[model samples]
Structures are given as C-alpha cells and as structure tokens.
Target chain A: MPENEFEKKLKKMMDDFHLPPSTSVWENVSRRLHEKRRRKIPFFFLLAAGLITAGYFTYHVSEKYKQNSTAAISYTGKNADKAGNYLLKDSAKLSTQKPGIKKEEKASVSNTLPGTQQKIFKNELNNKLITVKNSTALKDNSSELENDNAGNNKQHLNGQIINENNNAIVSNNETLFKNSITIKQPVTPADAENTLLKDEVQDNNLALKKDSISGLANQPGNSLKKSTTKTPVTINKTSNWQWGVTGLYAKSNLIENLTNLNIPSAQYSNDPLTSGNYDTAFKTTHAFSPSAAYAFGTVVKKKIFKNGYLSSGLNFIHLSVKADIGKTVDSVIVIPSPAYTYFVRGYAQPGFVKTNTSKYNFIELPVLFQQNFFHSKKTSLSYNAGFSVRQLISSSSLIYNQINNIYFSKEELLRKTQFQVAAGLSFEMNTGKNNSFFIGPQFTYSLSNLIKNPGNSSFHFINYGLQAGFLLHKK
Target chain B: MDYKNLVRNCLKGNAEAQKYLYNHFAASMFGVCYRYTKSVTDAEDVLQEGFIKVFNNLHRYRHEGELQAWMRRIMVNTALTYLKQNKHYSSELSYEEINLHPVSSENPVITLQAKELADLIRQLPTGCQTIFNLHAVEGYTHVEIGEMLGIHEGTSRSQYARARSIMVGWIEKRNENIKQRRYAGK
Candidate 1:
C-alpha cells in the first residue's frame, strides 16, 4: 500500500511550523547551564557559616563551665582559712593554761593532734604544747592512738577540757580530730595520692591542711581504704591550638557513570561495531579493580566546644585503579593521509586476563568537624565528618579515543579540582600533657566527577582507609 | 559567526555564544516540544531541559551533523522522557494493547492552519498522540518507535492507526463548521 498523502502533508507542514518560545525559556536554560560552577560557592559559604556558628556556641559553653569550676575552688579555700585562724588563737591560750600538765598527758595529746595543728601550736606556744621530733615522738604517737581506741572520743589538749560542740580547743583524739577536720580516712593505696586525691586547691593554707592529713594517714594503724570513685580529671584545653602529622593507607575503588563520552570499545575489545553505541562503552565487560592508596600530610586542630573540634589540613593522596586488559603486546598503527603517513606505537589488547594500573594523585585541603563522645584522663574517642577540596596533581594512563582510534593521555579528560566527603572515628591516647596519638578507620568518597567535561560519563574514586596521627598541643 | 565557531565559543564558556545558539534554534525546538507535550508550559519545560543537555553534550557533537538536527533529537528524547516520568503525562502515556480497525485511506482534504492542525493533534489521547507523532511526523518506523517507547511494534502500529482515525474525524467536523460559516456569509 502507498503511503497516505495525509501523512505527507502533515510532515511538511509540521517541519515548517515554528512557535516562538516565551522569554523565560532562555532564562531557565541559561541559569541551569551556569549553575554547576556557581553552586559550589554557596555550599562552601554555608559550610563556613555553620562551622563558625558551632565554634562560637561551643566556646561560650566551655567558658561558663570553667567559671563555675573556679567558683567551687574559691568556696573551698575560704572555709580552710577560717579553720586555720581559729586553731592559731586556741593554741596560744592552751600554752599558758597547761603549764603543770604531765609529760604523759602531753604525749597522749600529740597522738590525736594533726601535724599541721601540732606544728602551729609549737610555733605559737614556744614548743610547750606539742613538738616535732623526727621518728621518736611521732612513732610513739601512732601506736598510742591505735591502743587508746577506748578513749578515742574524749581528749585533753594542754589540760583544756574540750566539749563535743567543738568550741573549747583542737582535739588530741582520733574521733574529735576526724569530726573537726572533715577529712575522711585515707582512701587511696598510695600514701602520697591519699592527700593529693582531694579536689585541686591553690590556697596555701589548704595545701598545709592536706599535708597534715597525709601525716595522719601515715600512722601505723591507719588502714588504706579503696576509693571507688577514682575519677581522673580530663582537662578540655579548648583554648589551646594543636598541630599534627597524619598518614593513611587505603583500598581505592573507581565508580564510572557514563553520560556522553565516546568509548573506544574497539581499542579495548576486538569488535569494532561496539565502539559506536554509548552502552557498549559502559557495559560491565571491562573490569576495573582497586589497589593500595596512600595519603600523608600535616593537620591543625582546635577545640571548638567542650567536646567539639574543627580541624583542617593539607594532604597529598595517591590513588591507583587497575583495569583488566588480557595479554599486552606491542603494535604499530600506520595512518594514511594525503601527504603523510603517521606511525603510532601502542599496546594491543587480547582478552581480559591481564591487568593495567592507572595512577591519579591529588593535593587536598580538608575541613573536618569532630565531636568527642567519650573521654578518659588519658584517652578519648571522637567521630569526625567533613569535606575536602582537592586539586588533581597528576594522572598517568593512556586513554582510548573512539573518534581517532588511538591512545591519548587521560590527563586531558580529567578535571583539575574535585570535592570529597569524608567521615571517620578516632581513638586518641594522650601520650603526654601536651601531645597525643590517634588512630582510626576512615572512608572518603568523591562528590565531583573526575572527568573535566563528563558528557555522559562520570568517574569517581571511593577510598576506605586507616588513618594514624600524632598531635602536639601549642600552649 | 558560523555555527562551528559558535559551538567552539560555547565550549570556551562564552555566554554570548551560548545565547546566540539558543536564540537561533529555540523557536523550531519549541515547536517540536509542543507537538510531543500536552501544554505550552510543559513544552517550555522540555525545551529548557533539552537545551541544557545540548550545551553540556556539545563537545560530543563532533560536527558530523547539523547542530540544529542534533539539538532537535535531544529535545525529542527529553520530551519522551518527560512524558514517561511526569505525573501529569505518565498515566496518559500508559499504552494498553487493544485491537484497532484500519482508518479510511480516502483523503479528506485538510486545509487547516499549522497551529490549528497542531491543536487538533494535541487533543488526541496522549498514548496514540505520541505514537502518531513518532511514526507519522518524525518518520521513525514502527519498529524503531517500539524500541524507543519500549512497546511492541504491533502496539505502536495499532495506536498510530487509532490516532490517525481520530485526527481525521476532528478535521472533518471542523471543515463542516467552516462551510456553514461561509454559507451564512453568502
């Protein structure tokens, strides 16, 4: 049957038909075409703003906590000063009134008196109330305090009768001294730590008070009790900046999404017709494998919040992707032109058993936000998430061209800069007061395509790595 | 400047060259989009998407074909993709396999204006309308249309036949109205 004349007329008329589009069509199209380049600017600005806001919030919270801590220290110091001055006044009165007290009674009094109190009394009363002799008097006092348990509640300090209300004079008995000082029995195994384990105090009188407690703890009968709440204080040095060097080893994988780039299937495969269609180039017939990758660089980290930190650094990353290309053989192709014949030397592909490797190296700057969820005095565990802006330093590979049927440098197709998303958790061990060592597993994936003009094909690399680093704090 | 030079400048990210290229081909491309889509707004959407693809894939053009022809194919593909994915058109484009009787081959002279003809075509059921445009207007064979639209070749042929008969009925009715109006003027 002949084609319908109606269809012929319709085609002719439609071919000539033209309707002017609304002006907004161009506006939309133009905006979309240019938006790719402009999109990054706003994203980076938003990220920076977010970081700044988070840092500011963390700083204020940490400062408020520090202020509250300082207030606690001052409150504890004031009470210690009051106790010290009161003891000094009572010792003076005891020395004048207790002139006829026997040596036996004086020795008993020294057994219950704390060392700081005894030292103060000796100074104020001209060595009449209590005296410090290296081993002889102190040793006898320790044994006497233990055997005199029956008389623990009542004690005579320089023959002054002290009442239970704690107003008359300082006690020479273990029970009265414990009630007056509020110093619990030594809870630490170490004799030194028993006194130092108390919350940190800067006042001189408080230091002397703790020292006197240590003297009591050293007595022969005193038993060291186990301290169940042994908290090792971890100072968040949020204001201090730290610098570090990091190194990573990873397994890298390449992801390819073909869009418009022509794939020379004929060069890699024996079939020439396969090179014409877009799908043939992207088909899973070609195998791409990953090898070892490494990254190394210096980083600077600063604490932003009580548990948050913002860190950025420069790193050099070396990545390798291997493609299976059967057995490789040398081949020369002769090109015929009007006036010249060009000879191009390259590799010949047979099957998919052999492999070839390609190297892509990048210099990257990363901005990472880390928050520590767990902290001990000597160790901390934190998770970090952020992005990196990377510049392609070099690429080494021969790319196949469908149009020319020849090999070209892949550098021509690769973009200069790309972006990546990175996330990881780190376990940090504080080696010294101002230094730490950290190690963790990290994963980084590319956000931008590797190809400069990824017409139909998008290429990216994903890396799974173990990162280790050392940080030195700068005070 | 010539199209080759214009394309080269566009590749260099020259805004003026891109605008020039869009201005040169946008009207014809919009006409193509309008035929495939349901409304003027939908046509413009496809036109916008199509032009972006054209510019992004401009490097692959290879200068082997007319730039206008290359862009038109992109627009056509973009329209078909829009029809399948767009909620407004996806139900309309869903084709059911039904037997269609052959339409009359006797020519009914169609003297309607091009815009009038396009409007009538738009009024056809979207499934048949697309198959009609693909096979009748775009010159794709029934087999190619089946492959492009992911349907059986027989279904495409039947849908096109149904689309043609509906179009003829609309054209004939409009001709009768014109005739009556002319007689009243006399």
Candidate 2:
C-alpha cells in the first residue's frame, strides 16, 4: 500500500509527541531493584543457626530423659539407705545390752546378710555406720565426742554426703580426691559388726522392692502393667555430623560488559547488494545463548550448635556457552611489490552463524552454613548459604576478534581461579535409621570476573539448579 | 550528559546516572506506551516494564542507531506484550473479518490539538484503535502487523483500513464543528 499524506502527517505528529509518566513508576522500579539486591545477601547465618538448634535440641532432650531415669533409680537407693540407717541405730542401742543378747543379735543379722554380688554392693558400705558407732560411743564419753564433733567428723558429714550422691559423677578426674571417701583409720571389730548389720538391712530392702515390682506385674490392671514396664527405659540419640553426595542441573549464563566491545566496520566488496546486507549484519550486536550446566559433589557437614551446621564440599562444575558462527570462506591473497595491503584471513561471515559451543570445567570447593528450619519424625527442611572457591581445570572456547575479522582459540583469556557466592534450601526425608535423602534449589553467582583483564568487558557465570543428594548420619 | 557515559555509569550501578537516564526518556517512552494502551494507568504500567527491560538489556545495545529509537522499540514491544497478556485487551484485540467498503480517500486537514487527536484515537473501538496506532502512527506494514498479532495479512489490512476510515470520519466531524463556530463568529 502507498503512504497517504494524512498518514504521513499523523506519523510526524506522533513521532514528536511526549507525555511524562508518574513519579511513582521510577520509585517502584528502584524499590524492586533494591529488594532484589537485598535478597542476594548470603543466607549462611540462617542455615548455621538452624542446624545448631537442631543438634542442641536433640542432645538436650536425650539428656533430660536420662536424668529422669536416673532420678527414678535413685529413689530405690534412698530407701535402701534409710533401712541401713535403722540397722545402725539398732546396733547403737544393742551396745548397752547384755553380751549374750548382743551375740545373739549379731549371729541373727550375719545369717540374714546376702551373698556378695556386683561391685555396686560396695556402694551400700557407706561411712554412716562408722560415723554412727563413733557418735554413739562418744555420747557415752561426753568429753571426747564433743571434740570429734567440732573437728574432722563435722567436715566429713558436710562434704562426704554431697560427693557420694551427686558430685562424684559430674566432677572431672582432677577432682577425684575431693569427691572420694577419705577414711583416716581402720575399723574396729565392733564397727565391722555394725557395717555387716547395715549391709544386711540394705539387701533386705532391695529384695522387698523387687518383690513389690513382681507383685505389680502379676496384677490384671493396666496401671500396674504400665508401672512395671516404666522401670526400664531406652534412648535414641541424634548424630552431630553428616556426609552426603549431591548433584545439580541448572541454566547457566555469563554476564558480559558491553561498553568495551570495539566492533570494527565490516569490510566488504564494492557490490552494492553485498555491502547492504553485510552492513545490517555488522550493526547487530553479537548474541550468545546459554546451555544447561551441571555440578556433582560430596559434602561434609558438622553441627556447630543446636540448629546450625558448617559444611564444605568438593564439586565438579561444568559451564558452557553456545554461539552461532556463520559459514566461512578461506582464500590465499597475493600482494604486489609496490602496494602493501593486508587482508584478513579465515574471516567468518556475520549472519550465517551455526552452533559453536564453548565449554568450561572447574574444581570447586564450597564452604556453606546449613540450618534446619523445620523437622519431624521422618522429614526436615533446611537452608544453606556461603561461598565457593573454584579452580578452572580446562577451557576450550572460540574467541571472536571483530577488528581482525577472524576466529581464534584462546584459553589464556580467563582467570585460573574464581570465587562465587552461593545459597540453597533443602528438603530432607529420612529413609532409614541412619540415612536421609535431600533435594532443593541451589543458586550460585561468581563474585569475580571470568576474564583476567577484560578492560570494559566482564564475564561472570550465574547458575541456579536443583540439587539432590543422600546423607549418612554419624552417631 | 554523554549517553555512553550515562549507560556505562548505569551499568556500574550508579543511582544518580540511572535516575538521570530514566528522567531523560520517561516522557517520550510514556507517549509511545500511551498510544498502545487504553488508559493512563496501563500506559504507566507498560512504561515501567519497558524501562526495566531497557536497563537490564542495555548491554546488548551496541550504540547502533539512535538510543531513543532503541528504547522506543523496547517500549512498543513491551506494550504489545502487555496487551496480549492482559485479558481485557486480548479479548478486544480479536481480529474478525469485516465487510469491505469503498471509503473516500480525500485528505481532510486535522485541526485538533495533539492531545485531542490522541483522545479521539482512544475513542475508536479497541481493535480499530490498536490497528490505527500500529499502522498509521507506528508505521508498521500490514504484513509485519499480521505476523506480530498472529493474524492473516489481509485481516490486518482490512482492520487498518477500517481504523483509518473511522479516524478520518471523527477528525472530519471535529474540523466541521470548529469551522461552524468560526463562521458564526464572523
């Protein structure tokens, strides 16, 4: 269709037109960009906090259950101690009786004493028997008892009781002397007899408790059955260290700096048709398309606190870029002796670019902080963030030189080592007692440029992909 | 300010440079978006989206042609995408075959102000308004418009003609009203 004058006038009027957008549009754009930047901060702290919390909570709950069980067993020990004290008191009274009555009581108590069993029987031979006899003997002679009470016996009473009950288990080896019994002298025959009597009483009390438990188990009621079963307890503890193998597939791209791209004008033949087509091609910016990148690695994680973990891994990462390079014509040119004119050899045409891919491989070591955000009996969700150190292992890529109008191979253009910031979220499902499988999205961005000195051109690789792996819990 | 320096500074994340670039092109780009969209709010939305793409893809622009032209292309594409994505515009954008009629080719002088002219274009049916703005104002050919809108070339031509005929009628009516008032004053 031919252009009408009215359409031309309208086009000119529209071309010169202008209307200002509202100020809030800029505000919204700025705010979104700012938010995107803020979101990019490493999530290392959150991951670490979560893992540490998880580890600590697991440890604390187990310890608490252990304490409750210990308290229950100690209840029986207390009852046995009370019975031993009663026997000691009776021996004190018997000291005043006739020698015959004392002998009969001693023989009867000796007969009732149970056979020596476990080493724990020594716990029943506490110093209370000796203390009681000494105190009772002293009461008969008031002057001597008062002096003993004011001296070492008072220290023994205050310190030894605490050591025997609680401190002995918790105190370190260095504090052994303080927590151990410090009996200064040997026991007399009378004192020995009293100790034997206390042991018999403790044995009898233990036997009575065992009989009561059996009696309760024999009952038909649910409550009695529960009481008998509750006496024995078991605990399952969580592991503080884990090791896993992970793999990821993601879209990868390099962000290039465009300002430094110095594209020279296309040099073409004098043919008008050929120059016109080539001019349009030369004016267009070269475009590189990204391909799917992959990474595989093994990670080692250590619980740093109740809910956080510190993790590090060695990964093999592959990144690639594909560029469409057009068909090329190779020709030998001869120059005359008088005029020195250089011609660009091996120059590929602009518009006919087919698929030419460049590949990059790196050995990367990632240091991350992982945290468990949610957990259940069989599943958990955690997030991780940190940094990575990558060493380029190999590079095979085609470099386009616009000034010379040629293609060349150059691996030296890129830096050998690169640093990247990374973050991820993982959902883990425990498949067995000591193993779990986890999968999540992982994002990694290079902090340093790939090109050594790109002048105004910079290239940085960005990767985001799903990572799936299995971990073995170390108990 | 030099545009090369401005673009470089913007790429380096300079806030002042970015604001300066946006302020320099916001009005003209908003005008392009306004022509493509139905209302000011929608035009602003398209303008916002277009500027974001411009900033993000600024590296691809190798200083070829005018920077305003580059930005304007992005704005137009963004507006087209917005229209297709929006349910209201997409439904109105359906291109059905219309009866062919011979309309007068006589060119009447458009006496309306630019703002009035834009408002008059907006008053046309959504299909006619879009086709008129694209064909008459943006200068897209029927074949190109057909490919862009996923319609046949003949359908695009018919739509463009219908829009042009209607726009001519509205402009003629406005001019006649102005002439009547002037004659009464005389």
Candidate 3:
C-alpha cells in the first residue's frame, strides 16, 4: 500500500491547528473602539440632569428665603408704626366701654385701671407677594376682634347714643393715660415678645403679629440690625479666555505597511538579513512620526434666524511627537522561530513582532462649520463639520539601513516636512458659564511626505488615524 | 492575596475583590492575548475585555472547578473572537500540505530560556503558532483545533508541525550560542 506523501502532509497540517482555550478573549474591542473611535452621547442627558438638580435645590432655598423674609418683616419700620397704632386704637375703645359719671369721676377711677389694652389691627399688605407676617397679623386681629365682644355689652348697657359714647370716652381718659405707659413699655423691643404672649385679654391678632416680629428679631444675622431691607436682588459676572493641555502619537510604520527603500547589504551577520526582490526605483530611505495633541478654540456666535444664533471659531491644536521606529518595533516581542522538522519543508515561518516607537511634532488648523442642534440661554450642542489641515514643521523617522547584510539603525528621518487633511465629528459640552470640553474622533489622512530626496521612487506615505481632543473654548 | 478568597468575595460584588482578581489573572491571560494579538495595545485590549468577562461570569462559577481555569477559558474565547474578526493569521497557508512532522525528541525547545523560547515561538506565522500551542502543549485534538482556528484538521497539523520545526531550529542555534559562550568564558 502506497501512502500519498502530500495527503499525509495535508492531514498533519490540519492536525497542527492550535486552538486556544475557549475563555474570555478580546471582548474589550468595544471599549477600545469607544476610546479610539465612536460617536459621543448627546449633551442633553447631562444638561437635563444638571438643570433638574439645580432647579430642585434652587426651589428649596427659595422657600427657606421666603420664610426668613416673613420673620424679618414683623420687626421693622412701618410694621412697628402699625403695631403702635393698633395698640392705641384698642386702648381708646376699651376706655369708652362704660358710660361715664363725669370726667372728674373717671379721673379718680384711673388709679385702679388695668394696663395695656388689646387692639384691633389691620395693615395693607401687597397681594402679589404675601408672607407669613401677613397671615399672623390677620389671624391675631380676628382673635382680638372676638375679645371686643365686651364693647357690644357696653352698647347694650346704654343704647348706641353718640353723646353718651363721647361722655364715656371723656370719663375713661384717665384709664387710657394709665394704659398708655404700660403699652409703651411692651413696645420697647426687649420684652415685646414676652409681653405680647402675656396679654391674655389682648386681641389674639395683635399677639400673633408681635410673635412674628420678635421671631424675625431673633435671626442669627444682625438680629438687632437696624438696617432695613426691601427685596432680594441678583448679580452677574463675565470673563472670556479658555486654555488647555495637548498630547500626540504618530508612527511611520504603525501598520507595519513597510514603505521606503532599504539599502541592499553586501555582507552577512549572525542575524538574518531580509530584502525584497530588487526594484530599480526602490532605495533605502527613512520615515518615522508620532504625536498627541491638545487643542483650543474660540466661540464666535452671530444671531441669525429668529430666536437662533450661529456659532463657529478658530481651532488650534498642538501635537507632541517622538520616534525610534525600526529599532523599537524590532525589540517589542520576539516571535517563535520554527524548528526544522520532518512534517514541513522549505522555510518554516519564523515569528517576529516589531516594537517600533516613532514620534514628532505638528500643529493643525481646522475651520469648522456648525449647526446648533439644541440651544438654551447659556449653553448649546452644535454639530460641527469642516476641513482640518495639519502641518509638519519639525519631525523625525527611523531608517532600517542594510549594513553588512543586516538591518541597523538610522536616525533623524523626518528631515523634511509634510501636510494632511482631517474630517470628523465632535461632541461639545458646556462645562461652565462660558467654557466647554468637547471630544470626538476625527479621521485624518496624510496627503504628502515629510522628506524630499532628489530621486524618483514610488514609495508612498498613506495613513488614516482616529484623532480625539478636549475642545477647550469660551462660549 | 489569597486568590480563592478574592474570587469568592468578588462574587459578592466587592470592588476590592474584583481588583485583586484582575491583578492575579491579568498577566497569564495577557500572555494568551499576546499570542493572539498583532499589537501590544491590541493584547492589552484583550486583557481588559477578558477580565470583564471573568468578573461578569464569576457569579455563574458555582465553584464547579478552579477559578483560574474558568478565567483561562474566557481568555481563550476572547483570543478566538479576535481571530474570528481579523482572520489575519492563516489565509495564505494550508496546514494539510505540511510534509514534515515533529517526533518525540529528548531535547525539546521548552528546555531553552523562557524568553528565548517565547521569542522563537512568536516567529511562526500567526496561524502556525496558534496551531502549535493548541495541539502540542494545550492538548486539543487536531479536529477541535481545526474548528477553533478556522482551518481543516490537516491544515492545523501542518501549521503545528511547521511551528515545531522552526522552534527546533531556534533551539539548536541557541544551544550552539550557549556552547560558544561557555568556550569563550573558559
């Protein structure tokens, strides 16, 4: 029986397929893709949350402020005068309750008269913004008005006759004068609260008003502050100037899409020297670039359609670059070199991983055209689209030159300059009163080269990268 | 850290427990990820995602087996996902065509320095190394390796054999290097 040698090799090749253990593997693709390239969440989510929180706290504070205002109103200027008048009116009414024998007779009775009569009180309060002070005053007045029922009794004693009422008032003038002194003592502010509470026969409305007044006086702030207040006020401050930091990373052979001409080696070394089938135009050259960026932009807004504004500005980006391409890419991870075996012949693939680090500097300018998707008095989210231009002023690259039939180092490869174009989406978030932090990925493609050698070669530099930034600007 | 206790506590949703679990398993899992990845950043990406799966599936652990084994399974699956997405390793080569096979030898590449062996192993084409690891060390049958690596069993066998041959050559060269060094030292 003859076994086909080719069949055996095929069977063996199939058998050699090494499947890794079926465990959790590269599920982080979503996260990295999100970090590298993805659309941003609409600003409304955060904006809504912030607004709701602020509104709630503001409402709570406003309620507290209103309560404090009521307390303060009870203790001041026109309010004090109203209190005095109320007490005086009540004093007169009480004095006139009984028909007088005569002025001389009433004067003698004054020595035995009770002090500080209760009075009916009512002050004109603005209907628009009523406070607890008004409620207390009105409530106390009602209760006190009930106590005035005694006056009805007086009317019963002597039918509602004018001359008799005048007589009663003249006779009780002595009692009125005696009550006046005691009323004045209570209004002195120190015992005003205690005095208001103790006056049982006094009108309850008057007592309540006194209570609110004293309560306002007891506030922690200048409780005794003689300074008067009318209403609360608001203030605003303005400033403009937004600044931020930048980061950058650019490499010539990130994809290991080896371009550029490698010089042919004439000798050999311990390490294997690799070369492509010679192309006449291809010569050894170097290319290396890496960068990260920090950007800033100014927001210039122009009012356009009814109730709308158009906002746009100049975007400035700074990138940091570093390079050591051929060497770094070579040293990253050593691949497993295949062993000579009976099952396979002719050039078993040797494993190799290039760890190249190439970087340099560049600044980009982008003029973005934006449409305001959503807007408010203070902030907005705009969908921006425009052309971005990058200029390579200073940079470097690593050249893998074949020396003695082995690859070796060559530096300062970005001895020339280049340019590129970028286009992409940006998500802007208003971070403060006039500033914002925007980040979105942009796709950038290189349009030209960084070096110029006087020769003819078709070696091309092509790349597409996802760019991200915090859009620092004043709105 | 007591890894077992960490796994147990992590199941309870303690943040500290989760972090410890990550630190203990991340390195080896990264080794698995590196074997599958084309870039360090890509490997790191795999490492992050694999840990997330480990943490997420921790509750389903049921103490059925070793926690590390469960985590390893997740990492392998993660690496396979990368394979499914990229298919970058073995599009050109077929394993079934391999003519040479590695027979049992007294001197194997495993005896070489771990770093050097790793270096040698990484040199095999993407699909070949995967085949070698799956069939020779991991002990999956060729058929199973075929299904996981997306190749015919014969292709798997060929890639694995080619990988072994390359490793043996590297091992031989490294041995020569050591001998040369010894002679030089003497």
* TM-score for the A-chain in each candidate structure: 0.48, 0.45, 0.29
Candidate 1's residue-wise lDDT over A296-388, tens digit each?
Answer: 999888765456778887899998876655343334444344322333344434234445677889888788989889876578899999888
Residue-wise C-alpha lDDT for candidate 3, range B100-139, written one tens digit per residue: 5653242432345433444455667766766765665455
Candidate 2 chain B weakest lDDT stretch, 10 residues: B97-106
Q: Indicate which candidate wins on lDDT.
A: 1
Q: Model 3 chain A — which ten-residue stretch has the worst lDDT?
A: A340-349
Put down candidate 2 lDDT per residue, A343-399, tens digits, no spaces.
222334343445667788988878788888886657889999988877788987655
**Per-model TM values vs. the true structure:** 0.42, 0.41, 0.31
**Cα RMSDs, all models:** 22.2, 23.9, 22.0
Better of 2 and 3 by lDDT: 2
Would you list the C-alpha lDDT of every candidate in the order shown? Answer: 0.61, 0.59, 0.40
Segments in model 1 whose C-alpha atoms lie over 4 Å from true places: A40-475
- Candidate order by DockQ, decreasing, is 1, 2, 3
